[model samples]
Target: MTDHALVLFSGGQDSATCLAWALDRFPHVETLGFDYGQRHRVELEVRAAFRERLARENPAWAARLGPDHLLTLDALREVSDTALTRETEITMQANGLPSTFVPGRNLLFVTFAAALAYRRGLRHLVAGMCETDYSGYPDCRDDTLKALQVAINLGMDRRFVLHTPLMWRDKKATWALAARLGGAALVEAIRVETHSCYLGDRTTLHAWGFGCGTCPACELRQRGWEAWAADPGKDETHD
Candidate 1:
């Protein structure tokens, strides 16, 4: 597409992958990150480092992706009760909303991103919210996304397309797609650089991108990695 794309980047695995995917698809890409006053402050640092590294490693990519592309909104820092933002203990619930589910998080993020897009004259916005691996978050559901898309357009008086590349894809499928779009090295870079840990622990290896591996996010990530490792042939290498 010739239009620019804005991504809701969390400096995490899925979002990182989504960022790369957006880069390949859109002529211009910008990222919007939230400093929602989560329990993990290290994630913000990690995100900053990621942007810097991406700029240094690939100058062309960096030039295409400007430093001004990174936008940090601090709306959630005030409300600190949810697991994703400020809870100390993480519960692994089989069903229902997890402690990490922040109320109106995606809504706020998407709203801000949409506003940014509208200002930049960009109609496309991409996010990495997957219902399959999500921790029972209502915002990650397909219906919510569709409704939000409509709401954003109606509210902003502009037509905007919300691109959920990993909406239906499971964790395994996510890994496969990452490999396909950005290759093994890029995927590996995402795994290491991206912060998926809710607790902000950077030590040890988990099934997920990087965390205790017991958390819902980590579990899904690990399972996806295992699936990819088991069947490397299924991994796509082309766009």
Candidate 2:
């Protein structure tokens, strides 16, 4: 197997940053995205453009960047009735998690990613799942992913390292990470090319990105952008 990595790029701010992180670390890195019939499927639209711009940001990254893959997991819609999969309102469940939590989304994502990695001879899997500043998706927890890594390795009988660079990072720190990876150019690319709205609204453009500015994703992004813009120096500890 090769020492290449496969990043679960969702065309969101965090995933874009993680992609850059992978390119910086790995000699060869590929990207994988899912089309699970999400309401914000618009995020998929910007993936190609973001990757193009990201490659141009650095010569080494362009050379290290490899093939891109997209998977159509329409089964998620059949199994998930969350706001992200349907037109329902975003709300907190009685269990205290957001309605946007797709039951096994991240689990399925990594599982499939592992399967793909097996065939592609890629040894590392990277994703942008975070619990620090997010809708309380249980699947995004560190414990969940750690356990999943063990399960995948056992079931597949292959050693694979799952990397979650943004696991402990908040949005402001995530923005800082983008700036660190590709400077103001990368930050602007994320601001303009990434999509994180749950409502799939792309008409209005905010300083952070394009979204309704009221959804949990937009609010979190906007808050982080404002915080970072006010004082990026406060992100020293983020590294």
Candidate 3:
């Protein structure tokens, strides 16, 4: 039997790319999105629309990649102290965690994904968290994910794999990966359809993903895209 992989998708560039990657690798892939009261409800809406589009375009792909897929909106809404999920205005710091960082977010999200995977007899849980463009979020680091993996296993009395396909890769490499798996069309679709701006502004494009082009997330995304566009050869993965 082909092993099933559960993806923690956020309907953003990285997560959407990771979802595509999972689709290419695993015969059985399901996506789980969190609607954590994010300031950008647009992201959740896009996620639902993407899911629907997939179902309409390729029902088999949707069936294999959608049946266990879910959106946990209420769970995130209940915890609204973070700016990303609440009304608080985001504050960007030079070298510290941004106000956009949601406390215990990935922990809670992955825990839930793991629980769902365990119940379904799936051993793999995939997430798209990159340390390179993460902007000081402690939870986005490799160490945090490794530690969480161990904790999840101990807590659930079962072994589970948390796969971060984008952990070591930068945005340029990520864009290349998307192209490799599904060509430029997929990459373009991701940029156009996904939501990355913490503030929900979608008027312009930032290098890493689409956003306000001013927030730290937008800055990192913009820089990455500029870097890649300047030198496509920089990404060895590019064909």
Maximum-TM-score candidate: 2
Clashes of 2: 0
Residue-pair clashes per prediction, in order, are: 4, 0, 4
**lDDT for each residue of candidate 3 in 1-239, tens digit (9 for 90 to 100):** 23888888888878887887777777888888776667877776788666565555555566677564665557666765667867877786555767788778888899989988887888888899878767677888999999999999999998898889888888878777777766666666776778877788877764455678776666666776776677665345421
Q: Which stretches of candidate 2 lie over 4 Å from their true place?
A: 234-239
Give every collision pair in model 1: 36-77, 84-100, 207-222, 208-222
TM-score between candidate 2 and the true structure: 0.97
Tell me each candidate's TM-score: 0.88, 0.97, 0.86
Give the poorly placed runs of model 3, Cα more than 4 Å off. Answer: 52-63, 71-80, 93-95, 204-210, 234-239
Q: What would the per-residue lDDT of candidate 1 be over residues 1-239, giving only the tens digit for each residue? A: 33888888888888888887887777678887877677766666677777666666655667667433545556565664667766567865565667788778888888888988888888888999888777778988989999999988898988899988888777788888877766776667777788877787788754445677677667777788898878855544333
- Name the runs in model 1 displaced over 4 angstroms: 52-60, 68-75, 92-95, 205-209, 235-239
Tell me model 2's lDDT, rounded to 2 decimals.
Answer: 0.91
In model 2, how large is the Cα lDDT of residue 160? 98
Whole-structure CA lDDT of model 3? 0.76
